[model samples]
Target: MSASASEGPVECGGDEFKTDKNLRTSLSGLPSKIVAGSGFHGFKLNVKNTGDRAYQRVDFGVFAAQVDEEDYFIDTSHLTLQYKDPASGTWKAISLDETDEGAGYLGYTDVKAHESFSIDLRLAVDKSAPAGLGYAISIGMYADDEGNCVFSGDGSYYEFDILKAGTAPGDPGNAKPQGGKKPLPQHQPAGNTKIEPQGHLAQTGSSSALPAIALAGGAAVALGAGAVFVVRRRRNADSGTAA
Candidate 1:
C-alpha cells in the first residue's frame, strides 16, 4: 500500500469516530435514539495523537448548527458534556456552561502521544420538535501541551443532521455520519442558527467575566415586554399631568 493510502495527517490527529461497528450498531438501539425531553447519550469526538509531542490538554467543543430551524430549538440548558475516564472506564460530567461562576469550558482533558481522548456529548431536541428538524455538530481541537505549540483547525462541526423523534437509532437514515464537512451556500445556511458554542473563550469565563448570552426561550419576550413597560409608564405620567 502506498503512503497516501495509509492514514491522515502526520501530527496531532482526529477521526469521525473510533467506535466499533457492533457498538455503533448497538448504540442505535431503542435506548440511544435522539428523543425529545431527555438528554441521552449521543456521538463522541475521538482525538488521536499520532505526533511525538504530548499535549498538556486537548480542548474541544461540540456546537450546534441548525439544518431545520422550525418551531422548536434545542434547550441548551439541557445540553451537557462527558469525558470517559481512562482509569475507571466511566463517563464524567465536564459540563461546559455550568462551570464555576457561570459559564466556561473544561480544558483539563489531556492527550498524550499515541493515545486518544473521547468526549461524549449528551443532547436533547426540544419538545414538539418537528420530525424533519435537524442540527449538525461541529468540533474544534486545540493542543496546548503547556507549551502551546500546535492545533487542528476544526472538523465536520457542520456535517451532521440528526432527525427528530420517531426515528430509531437502528435506522440507517436516522442520522448523518459523524464528521464530513460539505460546502454550504453563503446566503443559504445549511445548518446554521442562533445557537452558539458553549466553551470557554480564551480560558476565561465564556467572555472575560461577563455572563454568557442566552437566547433561549422567553429572551425576546423579556426584551419586548420591558420596552412596553417603559412606554406605558411614560404615557401614564403624561396623562396625569395633562390639563
Candidate 2:
C-alpha cells in the first residue's frame, strides 16, 4: 500500500482541517515501510498548549484507527511508549498498560502553559503481515480544562503503509477481495419435491434423472428380445441339419 492510498479522504470545507487553539498536537516521522520484527523509537508525538490558561493534569493520548479491513495485520500491539525520567532525565521504556488512562489511550502526558510535551514513540510491524495493509494513526488530547484541542479539535490523522515486501513504492496495490457472494442459489424445495445429493448435480431436481433411467430400462428389454429371437433361430437351424 502506498502512503497516499493509506491517507484517507480530506474534506476541504468548514474547519475540516483546523487545529484547536487550546491543545495542538502532531505525530511525526511514521515509517513508510513498517516491519514487524523491528522497533522504531524515532517517531514522536508533540503536544503543545497554545491557550492562555495553564491546565493541570493535562492528558494526551495516542489512538489508532484501522481504516480498512486489512488493518488486522497491524495494531497497537506494534506500538510502544517511553518516558523521560524526571530524576535521571533519560528516556526510559514504559508499559502502555501502566500509563494508559483506562479509556484506551497511551499516556497521561501533561503540558503546561505555553509549553510543549513530547514523548518517544515506537512502532513495529508484524513479520507475518501481508505485503499491503495499514492503520490511520491519530493523536487524541483532552484535559481538565477543555474537551479537545482543535478548533475542530477532533483528531490528527496520518498514514503509513506496510508496503509490499518485494515491490517499490507507487506500485499497483493489490485490490482487497470483495466478500459475501450470494451462495449459489440453493435448490429450494417447492411442495413435496426433495433435493438429494445423488452426484455432483444433486442440488438439481430428481425429475430430470427419470428419463435417463427409463431409456436404460428400455435398452435392457430390447436386448432380452434379441436374445430370445437368436435362440429360436438356432433351434430351427439344428432341426434342419438333423433332417
Candidate 3:
C-alpha cells in the first residue's frame, strides 16, 4: 500500500528531523516464504529506517533461497522490486529488475531528526515459483561504491508453507466477470399494476428556457407592431377615399 520516511516517531512533527544525519538501516520484517504451487495475494516485508538521517542513493540486497539450501544459503537470481508509501498506504508496483542497482525504492525523512522511514516490500505471484514452503528471504544495505555496503548476515528468515504445483487460487473453471456483460432487461408484471406517478421539478435558471422565452416575446412584440401599422394604414386609406 503506502509508506512514509521521516524522523522521530512516525506520528509527531518536530525539529528533530535532519537530512545530514546517519540513517539506521534494518530489515526487521520478512515476508513468509512461499511454496511453488500455493497461491499468495499480498506478500509484504517492512524495510524500516531506524535512524534520523534522510537516506538516498542507497542499495539494498534481496535474497530468496529454497529450504533445501539450509547448509549453504542460495540467493534467488530473479528478483523484482516495488514500493509502498507509508503516509498514503498506497502500493505501487515497481518494474525494476535485479539489474536496477542505483534506481527504484526511495525514501526520505518525515521529521526534523530524520530517524524514521519505512519501505514496504512487495512481490506478485509467479506460476514458476518453487513448491516447498521452507525458504528464506533476506536483504542487506550496500553502498554505491564497490565493497562498501551494509551487510548483516541473514537479516531475518521466515519459514513458510508451500503449496503443491499447478494449484489455482480460486474455484476451478470460474472466470472473473468482465465489463462486456450486457445488463439484463427488467421484467414487468402481467397484470395492470397501480403505479405511482413520478414527478420532477424544473430547475431554476436554465439557459435553454431563457432563449425560448426571448424568441416568443420578440414574436409577440413584432405582431403587435404589425397590427398597429395595419390599423393606421387602413385609417389613412379610408380618409383618402373620403377626401
Candidate 4:
C-alpha cells in the first residue's frame, strides 16, 4: 500500500501510451478472402476507439503479403478510396487531392471513448495480380503521436489470404497457392498428327471400275448362251418343215 506501489505507470499522449486493458482494438468481419484478379471489391476495417480518450490522428495501413515491398506507411500518394465521419455515421469516398507523403494517413478528429467506428476500403486487384492461397493481404495500425511514431510497438499487423477468382463459390479449385509455380500440362501432344484432316480422294476408278468390268463380262456370257439356244430351236423347226 505504499505510494509508489499505488501509482501505476503514467500514460503518455503519443504512441507510447499503454493500451487500455479493457479497451479492445481489433479488426474482424473482413472479406476473409479476396479474389486476386477481381475488380474493386469492398473491404471493411472495424476500429474501435477503446481507449479512455478519443484518438485525434491514427494512421493505418493496407499491405500485401510481402511486407518488404509494401510501403503503406512511407508512401501515401494513392487515393483515399474510403473514409467515415464519426459524427454523421456516414461514409464517403476520398478522391486523391494531392500526391504528398501524408496522403496515406486516415485522420480522424475525435473517436469517442466507448463508441465504435469503422472505415470501408475498396482496393482494386491488379488485373494481372498473382493468386494467393495462404496469406494474401495484411493490415497494420499505428497510433500517430509525434515522438513514438515510427517505433515498432505502436503498430499492429494482421495477415489474410486472398480469395482467387475463376473459382466457383463453395468449389475451391486446385489452384497453386500464391508464390507457387504453375502446374504442368496434363495431355501429351499427338505426334505428327495434323490438327485439321486433309480430304482423301475417293479411290477414283481403281476399285469400282474392276467390279463394273466383271459385271459387263457376266452379261455378255448370258447373251451368248441365249443366242445358242435360239439357233438350236430354229434348226429343229427346219427338220419338221412338212409337218
Candidate lDDT scores, in order, read 0.32, 0.35, 0.30, 0.30
Model 3, span 126-168: residue lDDT tens: 5465554233233323221222222222222334334445654
147, model 1: CA deviation in Å?
8.0
Provide the TM-score for each candidate, comma-separated.
0.41, 0.45, 0.35, 0.39
Superior by TM-score: candidate 2 or candidate 4: 2
- Please tell me which model should have the higher lDDT, number 1 or number 4: 1
lDDT of 4 at 7: 20
Worst 10 residues of 3 by lDDT: 209-218
* Tens digits of lDDT, candidate 4, 1-243: 000111211112322333333223333433445555556545555455444654332333233221112221211122124544433445544332222222223332223455454555555444344444222121212223322221112123233344445643353332221221111111111111001111212222222111100011111211222233334445657797421
Tens digit of per-residue lDDT, candidate 2, span 48-99: 6666654333234443322223222223444444544333445554332312
Question: What's the CA error at residue 11 for candidate 4, in Å?
Answer: 18
Cα misplacement distance, residue 231 of candidate 1 (Å): 40
| Candidate 2 C-alpha error for residue 238, in Å | 89
TM-score of candidate 4 on Cα atoms, chains taken together = 0.39
Candidate 1 per-residue lDDT over residues 129-189, each given as its tens digit: 5443233332322322222113243223222234455655454333443332222110100
Backbone clashes under 3 angstroms, per model: 4, 7, 31, 3
Ranking by TM-score: 2, 1, 4, 3
Rate residue 107 of model 4 by lDDT. Answer: 34
lDDT of 4 at 27: 37
Per-residue lDDT for 210 in model 3? 15
